[model samples]
Target: MVLVQNTNWNNAAKALKNISTATNFQLDKILNLSDKELEKLVMPSGYYHNKAKTVRNVLGMYQTSFSELKKLDTDTLREKLLAIKGVGEETADVMLLYLFNRPVFVADNYTRKFFSKYFKQKFTYASLRKNIMKNFAFTVKDAQEFHALLDVYGKQNK
Candidate 1:
């Protein structure tokens, strides 16, 4: 979901899928790629240099395969990723929701402005997310998808 974070230019998902397809969705394959190679692959996503670095850095820490990554619990994985420099609340939440299969809602700037206006409630990354989970965590995947769909709607309406 690092790709989701960098979707400012072009179609971000396509750019990311291109890189994933080139590397065959393998962590080690992507890690073996030099910075320049990864940068070029991600150039269409915008902020190629920094986004490439963030991807490499995250993959560097997670050198093992996805099967191994699947063994970790959501909180442990979230804690580890959050400790990384490039991972923020939204990015970490994305990793937790999408990658770790946790029921986390990624609260972006859109979430804040939209929720504040509509719900008449102030929010921070922490508080808004807490309330979202409190209200929507009736089931795991459902809650995760709700967040994703909400984000897409917010972005489109903006």
Candidate 2:
């Protein structure tokens, strides 16, 4: 969520690297940091304060029920994630696909634009997600690659 929310990819990557290094990529260590420290760590990403809060909030949720969340069906898991602040549909789908290894397409703005250009159709987030899931048969990896490619295409076109 922090990585793609309003910030450019390079800035987000730098912020993520900084946070990972400081926390040794450990969730507990990150959670242990004071909010100001967490905000400083993610400064490069911009919107550090809100991003820090979001990171804390989502990780707090994970720290408590990660295993239980993983066991949930995709729909239930998506709903649970969506309920968290700062987790939009794209971020929720991202966690479902990458973290949980669920087969889901992230119909983010990039994907929406890609489809609009090539398919000559404009689709809302839910509509495109539903259309892709219903019409295409993709494994988790395939969906990941497709979303990445769409992001790459969108970036290049921009």
Candidate 3:
């Protein structure tokens, strides 16, 4: 999945992983949780109430489930994801890539910095991610590794 090394990502992901593990990765069970409960579980994420609400709002859009969501064509799923109130491009792409095994590249700050600096070309989020995907065109694993390496190397340099 998304292996971004930002503190917020690390904390939030660990909290979510714990919750998913305890609930057997059942999105339904997660949705069934009370707002207060979900907030408490996600406290480590910061803005727990907001994040919990966002998670509920996004997940509520799904009528079926995870496997069913996976069955949807990537375009349809991406549209549905982007329609959510607070979900942006990177967020949507992260879910698609990590959760659904879609080969979409995630353009994060580290990615932008690394690419623009190394390539000596300023790039927009979509353009940079597209360039990375185009150049690495082959497999999802390669894209994941590239993103992870950018984060890892970015952290070290910082």
Candidate 4:
């Protein structure tokens, strides 16, 4: 959740480090933190308060249904993640692709922009993801690399 809507990789990494250090990488400890405490730790990541709440909510969901969620098919898992308060289509697809090693493409802004600029085509999240997955048989690693390459290229070009 920390990476969702966050662009500064350095700040995200620092926030992760702070949280992990404070909690000793323990889920129970992280879950026990007060909102203010969690917000303080994640302050560098921006939108600290909302992000903290999202982090807690996502972790709570994981704590409760992690094994079941992991076993779900890609579409099912994406739907479940989308049901969460802070998880939009991009965040849901990100969790599906990265956390579960699902092959669904994350139709994030970078992907959408890159395609739209080059192809003169507009795509909604579902349409872009569907079209890409339909056209390419991307393995987990391929999807990861493709997403990373798009991000890097987008950053550089911008």
Candidate 5:
């Protein structure tokens, strides 16, 4: 669910460490900050400044309200995540499918490209996701495995 390409994690950690060096706040405190506060805390990370605020707010809301995010039903959690700023259908679907073990097909550029080439028709994200779910054997485990296999095949072919 936390799809950091190894190098990105190191870079992000280093940046966070630099920010922490100046601010006395701990990681937990920073993470729990309100949306506006978080926007100020994580400044100038390109477009991530606004995104960080949304992420923090959503996380804080879930932490305070749910106390255990993993316990929420996938559909409920997806809807909740979608309500947060900066979290669109793709992000919500990623959290539900990857993080919450829901049966969902994440329609990104790669998915769209592959499907379009195979089907010879342009497909929107909603339509593509629905097509996969409706046509394939719909199960969380199966969706996960199929997605993984598709990624592997894509990489190999590339």
Candidate 6:
């Protein structure tokens, strides 16, 4: 049984339609592209192709390997997600942290720039993710919210 069945099919269909409208291609064609190739095809703002490829790969991985993702433990699922193409640590962490209610911090360019500017810290992406996770006593929601808040703060302060 699919734990989280495609309950949002209508929303997914609508989003697919929007992508189709914007890109002039059917959903199937979009899905056919690999992550890196798809990333090259789409407009930067759309990021749709990359996202679609990731979703397709992830769903296929879950269906084929685990039967249902909700049945897997958080760490197991994170590992599974990281194995897929285009599924980096941040993306996997975001999926675990938000979708699966796991405690994990996601760091992106905004977080890195904001923190570096204010804290005068120099760290690579991996180290930055680790540093943020170590320093913040925040839930997944808090991390998301804080990231948004930092983006706003940076924009205004700039």
- Highest lDDT scorer: 2
Note the Cα lDDT for every prediction shown.
Answer: 0.76, 0.88, 0.73, 0.85, 0.65, 0.61
Query: Candidate 4's residue-wise lDDT over 92-147, tens digit each?
Result: 87888788888878877788889999989898888898888888788989989999
Per-residue accuracy of model 1 over 70-100 as CA lDDT, tens digit each:
6778777777788877778888887777667
lDDT of 3 by residue, 68-89 (tens): 7788997798877878776778
Worst 10 residues of 3 by lDDT: 1-10
> 58 in model 4: Cα distance from truth in Å?
1.1
The deviation in Å at residue 89 for candidate 1 is 1.0
By the TM-score metric, which is better: model 3 or model 6? 3
Task: Assess every candidate by TM-score.
Answer: 0.79, 0.92, 0.76, 0.91, 0.65, 0.59
Candidate 5: count of backbone clashes, pairs at least 3 residues apart or interchain: 0
lDDT of 6 by residue, 1-158 (tens): 01112223344455545556655655455566666655454333344565556666765665566557757886788777788886887667767766676666666556667778878986677898777667768776786677668657755765
Candidate 5 per-residue C-alpha lDDT over 1-158 given as tens digits, one digit per residue, 9 for 90 to 100: 22221123354564465447645545477675665665554443434565566556655665576546568876688778778776777777877777677788877656777788889999998899878767765698877777777656655654
lDDT score, residue 137, model 3?
A: 65
10 Cα displacement, candidate 4 (Å): 1.9
Instruction: Extract clashing residue pairs from model 5.
Output: none
User: Which residue segments of model 4 deviate by more than 4 Å?
Assistant: none
Model 2 residue 112 CA deviation in Å: 0.9
Residue-level lDDT for 128 in candidate 2: 91
Decide which is better by lDDT, 4 or 6. Answer: 4
Model 2, 39-70: lDDT tens digits are 99999988888888889989999899899999
Better of 1 and 4 by lDDT: 4
Positional deviation of 7 in candidate 5, in angstroms? 13
- lDDT for 9 (candidate 4): 75
